[model samples]
Structure formats: C-alpha cells, structure tokens
Target: MTTTRPVLYLFGSAAPPVFDVAAVVADAQGRGFEVCLGLTSTAARWLEPRKAGLERLTGHPVRSAYKMPGEPDVWPKADVIAVAPATFNTVNAWALGITREFVVGVVAEGIGKGIPMVAMPCVNAAYAQHRQFERSIADLRGMGVRVLYGDGGFVPNLPGRGKPEEYPWHLLLGAVEEIRGAQGEGRSS
Candidate 1:
C-alpha cells in the first residue's frame, strides 16, 4: 500500500538496549519514516509500563503477538525493517526460520518479500564467542539483511559490562535511510 512516508517496521528483542526504544522510535520518525513498533514477547513485558506511551508516540499499537487470523492489519505495509538490539536467541531463531516470536516472524517473511532490512545484534562477548552466533550472522547476511555487528557497527561488550546508553541506535537509523535511498535510486534508473 502507498504511504505518505516510508513505513519502517522497527523490531526489538529482549536486550538491555530495548528499554531505550522510545528514543529510537522518535529518531526513526524524525528520519521521515512512519514507524511501527514490534517486540519479542520478553521485550514487550519489559516495556509494559510504557506501552501506552509508545503507542501514542508511533500512532500505532505496540505489537508483540501475531494478530488473529483474518484480523485487519493495523500498520502500514513496511517499506523497510530494522531489528535492533537483537539478542543471541533472536538472531539464531530468525536465521533458523523459527518464527515463534512476532518480530522474528515478520522479518523472516520480509526477506521473501524482498523488503530492505537491517539488524544490529546486542550480544555480549561471551555470546559472540559461540559458534552459532557467527553462523547466524552469516546466514542473515546471506539472506540480504544488512547486519550491523563488528567493525563499523555494534561491538560486543564484556559480559556484565555493557553500556546500554551507548547502543548504536543511530547506526540502525542511518542504515534504514541508506536502504531507502538505494531503493529510490533503483526505481529511478
């Protein structure tokens, strides 16, 4: 469906940085995106107290569960998706096509729809050391999702030493803009 502004599906997992989602949503909206917020069930519970405020901020419902079958979609069709503060479990579940969670399910289906997508993992150094973590990152990248981890993206912190205030939320927003710009170029060419 056509929208006045690009629709961005912003999904979050149960990471410490997920608590900072209010600012992230505002940042996305400021970047010319109609933001729709989705979260892992755990993250939803973590932010329960702020759910109403988030709905007001995004002008849409905060979703953490699949809509009932045949229910009308409440949000605009996504032009792009950004999954930030992706936890180790979320990254693996998505890469393995395990869509038990609402956020993972949308992003998994988004891949087949050819929607531009980006992900930034919030794993610690210990989780990053796991073999599955590296494989999952590669798998998501192979499926055309731009993963913001290592180098210029999110760097894993030592366990128990994470600075949630320092999560690279801006980088995720920047990638969304870059993806939108690239899509615009492709359409014009």
Candidate 2:
C-alpha cells in the first residue's frame, strides 16, 4: 500500500562487510524492490561511497548523520527498515529512543510511527552478553522489533581479520527473508 521499497540502515564498527551490503542490495534489487541506504559514521570510513554512487544505487541520498547537518531519517513511506551489522551502541540507542544522529533518528522515528524494524546485531559474545546491551535488546524486542542473532550471524575463531566474506551469508539472507515476509512479499512471485 503506501510502501516505498525497503530502506536498509547499515552500521558497524571501524570495518564492516561491504560485500555483504552489496550482496543484500543486489538480491533485493533483483527481486524487483528499490533500496535506500544509510551508513553509520565509522562505516563511511571503510566503504567510502561516492555521493553519486550512493544516490544512484539507493535512489535516496546516502550519508553519515554526523557529517551532515540536521538528522537523517527514513521516510515514513518506507515499508521496511533494516539495520545490518547493527552496532551495540546503535542498537541500544534505538531501543531507548535516543537520536544522536541520522541513523538513530530514523530508528526512533520508526518506533514512534509503529513501523516494523529489523536488526542484525553484529557484536562479539562479550559485548553482546553485557547486561545493559542485553537489556536494550530485550526492550527492543518487546517493542516489536525483530532481532536476528547468534553465531550464524556472529563469526567466531577469527581474530584481527575483517572481511565482508567472513560474514555469514545464510544468516544475512535469513534476515532479508524476515523483512520480506514481514512486508508481505514472501507470498509474492
């Protein structure tokens, strides 16, 4: 009904899987859905998306909220909002309705507008197990935010290596499927 494709809000630490991002985008676009992208501050550093490149890919302005003035938020017209490689900080902020930047603002807006939001928390076991972090995740779930977690999404036994290919394809695809199912696209051809 008034859904404008799907907007994916990507965030991470110093490094994230650009390949995963590309793969997800490719899959979604191939499925005949438009995609919009929002990058977190640190993510911008590793995967530098040219202004025009991002604009052309997402058909929406791509930016890191900190670098831009005012808050960048997802339009209410969006059908789905997904945070892939969701940082612990970002996840907690979203659950608390805190808006320190564009991505956070978009998450808060999604909550306020009752928009369906999905997140793939990409953090290590230690950080993820932290009491505050766990609580924040619980809070988000209570509010109807779908969270995709576990080792399938978290790579183990890898130290000091940051590669997009290291990220689990199955888990990422599963998250994508979750969003599709939520958007009523699961039954679509």
Candidate 3:
C-alpha cells in the first residue's frame, strides 16, 4: 500500500530451477510486482553468472547474506514473497523459524511481519515423505504461508532425478496472485 507496485521478494533455493530465475522475474514483473531476489547460499553460486542481469531486472542487489549491523538495508520492504523451488532443508528450517541463512532470516521475519507468502517446494518423493516435511508443511500452512505442493501444485520427482519439465515454475506466480487476492479481500490465504 505504501508504493504503487507491490514489493515482491522472490526467494530461490538450490533446486535446479534456480537457474531459470530470469523467466520467473520477468513473469512476476508482468504481473505488476516489483521483484527483489534472495538466494539461499547454495543457490547464490548457481545464479552468480546471472547476478548482474538479475540486478538489472529487479533494480535491487540480489542479496545472499545479512548486512553488517551498521549497514543500511538495500532492498525495499516486501509486500509478498514467492519462493519457487523451495528446497526440503529450507522448508523445514523456515518452519522451525531457524535463521541460519539469509533467505531463512528474511522469510522467517516475513512471517512475523504478516506479509503474504507463497512457496513451491521442489523435493523428491522420498524427501517429501519425511515426517518432518509433512509437519513443516502443516506448520507453515497454519501460519498462513501457502505451500504449493502435492496434487495440483508440485509433484515430486524420483530421487536424484528431477526433470526440468516437471518443476512447476509456472504455478508459483499464480499462487502468489491467488493468495494475495484472498488476503486483499479479507479472505483466508
């Protein structure tokens, strides 16, 4: 509400889809979001080659770490977040509110800030079956973080074999819109 365009925090994990972030950024912008990118440490390297291009697309530094205590924040406050290809590790850590990494820190804090958020997990079926993964999904859903997983959302691939065609990157932007619209209309997200 403070700005004409929503400030979107587009967070990427270490999934193979992280390499295709340029398309995601373009899509979010097309949907009227002013995107900012944040990568999990593992994802930071995967995107290093595209960092400058990403910065140019987003008009903000692609941050992968916490700034020094005295350093000023560079990114604008987020209106919503879309974490496509969220990994199993980040999902569970975020559910536990662990701030071990920069992406986790921002997302954990986003939950507290009551910002609308949507996440699309990119885990294999074996990883998705873990008891903790189920619990984490429930916990996040309870806190109103939309987890785009299972059934109509993301379907798990075979262990050690994720096909790029099946990552479901296109679903995330729509999920964000649905959740944000629901929230905007005072409906449950």
* TM-score winner, 1 or 3: 1
Over 1-189, each residue of candidate 1 has an lDDT whose tens digit, in order, gives 457999999999999999999999998899899999999999999999999999999999999999999999999999999999899999999999999999999999999999999999999999999999999999999999999999989999999999999999989999999999999999999
| Residue 73 displacement (Å), model 2 | 8.8
lDDT of 3 by residue, 32-82 (tens): 889899999989988898899999998899999999999987877887898
lDDT scores of the candidates, listed in order: 0.96, 0.65, 0.88
In model 3, state the lDDT of residue 187. 51
Ranking of candidates on TM-score, top first = 1, 3, 2
Candidate 2 global lDDT:
0.65
The regions of model 3 sitting more than 4 angstroms off are 186-189
Candidate 2 per-residue lDDT, tens place, 79-131, comes to: 66777777777878888877875777877777878767777776665665678
- Candidate 1 Cα outliers beyond 4 Å, as residue runs: none
Preferred candidate (TM-score higher): 2 or 3: 3
| Alpha-carbon RMSD of each model | 0.9, 4.2, 2.5
Model 2 TM-score on a 0 to 1 scale? 0.75
Quote the lDDT for 19 in model 2.
34
